[model samples]
Target: MPVEPDPTRRSHESWRAILDATFELLEEGGYESVTMGAIAARAGVGRQTLYRWWPSKAAVVFEVFLDKTNIGPFLAGGEDFPTQLRAFAHGFRTLYVEGPAGTRLRELTGAAQTDPDLARAMAEQWFEPRRAPVRQALQEAQKAGVVRIDIAPDTALDLVFAPMHYRLLVSGGPVDAEYVDAIVDLALAALAPGATPA
Candidate 1:
């Protein structure tokens, strides 16, 4: 069902209205319930308007999450990679592992397993851009001799963050600071130059 949205909203206001309406529909039901017609009706925008900006329903839904979600890890990288990594991990915890967004993530993850468009849209529109800064930070650390060059930054990110995703999606484990620290500790130690085998 389309929620009541200000039909008069336009331009940037229309954009916000579109996203807001998408979020409302998501809350009212779930991923399955959100449709282009409902979104257009709710936002008082034409279906073409949504298509003008985003390719699909999943794309529009992802946009709402991106728009509402916090801009993560204020300090992109730091002199202390460990500290930076901790903050980054915590940022992920807060954004994708903890609350409403986290719940959406878990839901969409399962949803994506079936809907190829959603899978592709989530990865391309949502995950790819966000991963860049963190990857750049890792690359810089590697160049600075702070991180081992042998491991790719992408792989490092996966290693550092996979457990958080696992906890949120698979294991249903706690993603507290302690768990983050444990993952960081093990990951950094492995990624340290001249590191010894345990």
Candidate 2:
């Protein structure tokens, strides 16, 4: 008798193909161009397969963004909190300034304004999880006396990340290394343990 293929391995392969196809389509033609049918065709899987995994094109695309743009490695840089933060900022700046991923993010940001479900999915899947590690790092810094204990980790994270988002979504300013460094410097100064007002 012929040996049977492993269902788990096959399922993993199929999922990878679907995600890869979704990104390829997104890079090729923006958000409006991607559809379940197109992703299935590109992945060489059936439409039923795509639908079985994701309810919509936005769902598929969001999963791809989460998998592809994980900032974990970026957050693990340098010898100290300030250095690590600067590295993270540079990584974030580069991601948004230099790839199809940025285009996809911008599309999603605009779509989220009109689609509450998409907005919730992004917040729950992408935003919260990504921020968790950053928050943990901040907490650790505070414990080590490098960061101010009084300020919430969420506030510190906002100070570090908000400028990048503003530049990406609103101001349309340059997110170059210099700009990223400046943001990191300002954030570090504010987050320093003794910087709080008396």
Q: Which of the numbered candidates is closest to the native, going by highest TM-score?
A: 2
Q: List the residue pairs that clash in candidate 1.
A: none
The Cα RMSD of model 1 versus the native structure comes to 5.2
Residue 3, model 2: Cα distance from true site in angstroms: 28
Per residue, candidate 2 scores C-alpha lDDT tens digits across 1-198 of: 111224754487788888889888887888899888999999999998777766677777877877777543377744677777776778777767777767777878877887788899888776676667668887888999989999888889899789889988989888889988888888898888779765
Question: How well is each residue in 1-198 modelled by candidate 1, as lDDT tens digits?
Answer: 112234564377788888889999999998889999999999998998888777778667766776676555434544577777777787777776556887777777777887898898778756776677778888888999988998778888898888888778788888888888899898988889987556
Model 1 misplaced stretches (Cα beyond 4 Å): 1-17, 44-56, 73-77, 196-198
Task: Give the best candidate by lDDT.
Answer: 2
TM-score of 1: 0.76
